[model samples]
Target: MIKMALMALRKLAEVILAAFTFGIVVAIISSAPAEPTDPAIWSFEDTFLFVFVYSPIFFLFIGIPASIFIEGIMKKINLRNCVYTHLVHFILYVSAGSLLGTMVALFFIAEGFEVYIVVWSTIAALCFYVALIGLNKIIQFSKEHDEE
Candidate 1:
């Protein structure tokens, strides 16, 4: 029971970290100058503050449940090969990122923010996937080193 709880906690930590990283990347990307009239109007401080405040709630309500569902599916499939495991995880991360992006875009739209939904969503998803990939690599490296 304790082990299971620890595993769940670890997963939550991973998702939260990934979500915050995604938020940061989105804020930076969105703050870029788009046109002569709209020259990077978003304030970094404000964006970070907003994201920091809301991303955990969003992740807890949406991202974590979705990831747990995907993990359950993977376990049900009895996938043991490392390659298959990595592939499944990649798909999970990308899908989660896309879902998160869509939700964020919808929120921004509802709030009367003047932003391109598709662009921001895609950027957020890509940034999230990349961050997860980096995290995965680091974890793998550490595991390998520890086994030596």
Candidate 2:
């Protein structure tokens, strides 16, 4: 129980860190003009503040559940620690992210769908994956050091 709690805490930390980084990237992207003549959609500070504030909620709702579901599937399949598992996980996350973005864009944003919504969500998923993997590596290293 304690170990599980620790893992959950670690995962939450990873998600928040990933959200922060993802927000930074989104802010940069959203603040730039898509074309030479077009004005940027937002000021950098405004975009950053909005994303940085809201993105953790988005990830907490969507990302944590998806990750837990995926982990359950991996465990059931007896492939949680397999060498090729990360690739499968990556594909699953990217596909899910794309589908989610499409749905959100179609239903919420406006009358027309924006491609950048999909792009940003996909990037956010990738950010979460990278953070998870990095955190896992760090934890493993720390465990090994403690054992030695």
Candidate 3:
């Protein structure tokens, strides 16, 4: 029961973090000075719309399915090894993050936004992966120390 609760809490944390990061990115983009006569550039309304449209699609279509698949694979392996489990989780997280980021960038490009989609999306993915990895390591280390 405790483990299940903890899992729920962790998932909640991940969602919150993703939303926060997305908000920060939107804020940064929105705060930039507008280029006169650049219709491709995003206005504040455009940024908000992008976020509003993309967030649910990302969570529902990409994030949830990827997470479920990864979890299923991990469970099937039944490996009682933290290192292997962490590695698999890290790789899966990176893959999902990258895929989602790329999709968002492509969507923006398709909508006629003049942003540097590849560079920004890659950076976003990397940052998210790094954050997740760091969080995982900290949790693992804490659990190990507690066991000791």
- For residues 23-124, write the lDDT of model 2, one tens digit per residue: 788888767554435454567777788888888887889888877887787677776466679888798788878888888899998769999889888888
Q: After superposition, how far is residue 146 of candidate 3 from its true place, in Å?
A: 4.8
Judging by lDDT against the true structure, name the best candidate: 2
List TM-scores for all candidates, in order: 0.60, 0.79, 0.47
How do the candidates rank by TM-score, highest first? 2, 1, 3
Residues 1-148, model 3: lDDT tens digits: 9998987667555544554566567657665466646767777656756774565445445555666676788789877888987787777666666665666666756666434654454444444445455567778899999999
Weakest 10 consecutive residues of candidate 2 by summed lDDT: 32-41
Please give the CA lDDT of all the candidate structures: 0.65, 0.82, 0.62
Which runs of model 2 end up more than 4 angstroms from their true locations? 28-49, 80-83
Q: Distance from true position, residue 36, model 1, in Å?
A: 12
- Model 1, TM vs. native: 0.60
lDDT, residue 28, candidate 1: 82
Misplaced by over 4 Å in model 3 are 34-62, 71-128, 144-148
Candidate maximizing TM-score: 2
Question: Total backbone clashes of model 3?
Answer: 0
Ranking by lDDT: 2, 1, 3
Residue 63: error of model 1 in Å? Answer: 0.9
User: By the TM-score metric, which is better: model 1 or model 3?
Assistant: 1
